[model samples]
Target: MNTSKQRPVRVAIIGLGWWGQKMVSILKSCGTELEIVCAVEPNPAAGDFCANNGLTLAASYDAALARADVDAVILATPHSLHPEQIDRGAAARKHIFCEKPLALTKADAERAVRLCREAGLVLGMGHERRFEPPIVDILQKASGGHLGRILQIEANFSHDKFMTLNKSNWRLDPQEAPVAGMTATGIHLTDLSVKLLGAAYDVRVSCETLASDFRQGDTFSAHVRFKGGGTAYVSATLVTPFVSRFAVFGTKGWIDVRDKAHVEAPAGWIITRASVGSLIEISEVGPAEPVRENLVAFARAVRDGRPYEISGEDLVNNIALLEAIIRSAASGEVVAVG
Candidate 1:
């Protein structure tokens, strides 16, 4: 087992929307050490979620941040709103675990990381794919020289429908959705791509405007070139029926995760690796509770004061790469991503 043992983290979730509510549900089951102390949400669904779970619901993040009871804050608000919330949480001396992209722009993402650093707080971005037990096991196999020399990976995440019109939230807006479904979700693929493939160098992307109702970019695809002569050509389509999932390919084998559909569409996962004698296929079904692993990882990171499997720098760089994809899609050119 890992040597890090942290006391249960005192957690608060801001913007308890669809995903945010799930975060709370998973954290709730995380034993007595972990706790959901407060919630900051404008929507009634969030309030209901907290009430049903017996969690304290705060009317605003400002109030939640001021409270001494909250030890950490999870920013599940919106893409454009992430940076400021993280900044506020850091200033309030709370550890932060944000959903994705970090922010709508690279500068904003950079500032979020910088602010978190200044506060000496552990900043975790929710790229929960890294926590998938099978995925973790696969990465270990590769590092153990079972894959010989790694080559390429293809990761994809798609979404077509959203249950947002009822809520009157920012996600339905183009500014919040940003570069379509990719920024909202596919950054997981890019972040995973970086971990498996090495530093992504140049990104060439293409996005189609599939939704007439949506104001900004809707459907997006990108090809990221990794420095080690590997590639992660990732895509996110809002027109598709599936939700979040990931796939990785190495020289000796390939692994695919089919996230069980939950409106979130995680389904299950399948792993295939090549051995000296034959091919091996291994699969693991997801939990009735999916977000528990993510919260536990964060709580452990906070308690241990060590590096997590995921980080803010990775989120910023992934957002930077996503931003490059948007630029490339707009300009029809290859964008160099640092």
Candidate 2:
């Protein structure tokens, strides 16, 4: 690892929406290795936020990229804009940390990964659940064979956070957020499932509007078959109360985790494990700053030459799985993942 940490990595944060503001708060709280040089938001309302936070407001993304002081950019923009913005950022020779669901399609995701790779810039992802304490422990146990031959996985990440958004919101637009809650909540579950179970071979999904006014849909459930012979069932609902749970079953035993609150709130986590012949055990994991940890890791990759935890393969595969889910939901048939 490169030990030259003489200066903090300066980054320009793009977008100042709810998640964007949350990221700004997280960085302000614990981002010692990172410096928020500027905030790029076209929305005039965000000007007050920048003023109060003492951050310079860039007139546009182009303006931010033109600055020599900005070493990286944190993209918290709309889903459809990711691919184009990534292309532009790479051309500007700026490292990028994009939010979830890198792109709406596999081809776009592949191009984004390729551009960042060719530019020799770090590509960071916003799947901060991997940095959560209980999640990290669960992955370690599964990888260490403590779970013994994984058979199946089940996960649900649901919330009503977007139910209040206007029907015209980009998040509710079919072009930007197809297949309902998949982009907002279910994608995180798929990312975790891919890590635990391996590459998904195919998927069958169902989506329905249910209670939300959004035209695309509000609820979705998917069944994924992994190439490694394991299967997973994942679901998310946009009209439900906060519910984040994950479970893995193996030939030897099973493990379950329940988060007391959302990743942003960080209440705590309850984990339970049971072996075939042993008693079930339950434990509690205290609240942690996973979002901050993820950004810090990204800054380290940019400044200290450390490898970011999320890999290029993981980024592309997750997007491929998402594409399959969207297709399956649309056709009401099983869709194969690349």
- CA lDDT, every model vs. true structure: 0.72, 0.90
| Candidate 2: tens digits of C-alpha lDDT, residues 1-338 | 12237878888999999999999998887546888999998889998999999999998999999998889999999998999999999999999999998998889999999999998899999999999988888789888998899999999999988878876778888888888889998899999988887789999999998886777788899999999899999999889999999999998889899999998789999999899899999999888989999999999898878898888888888999999999999998999998
- Give per-model CA RMSD: 3.5, 1.6
TM-score of each: 0.87, 0.97
lDDT of 1 by residue, 245-326 (tens): 5666666666666665632434556454455556666656655333567767777778776567765566667777777776
lDDT of 2 at 328: 97
Error of 1 at 289 (Å): 4.6
| Candidate 1 runs further than 4 Å off | 1-7, 44-49, 163-169, 243-245, 260-267, 275-277, 280-290
Model 2 TM-score is: 0.97
Error of 1 at 335 (Å): 1.1
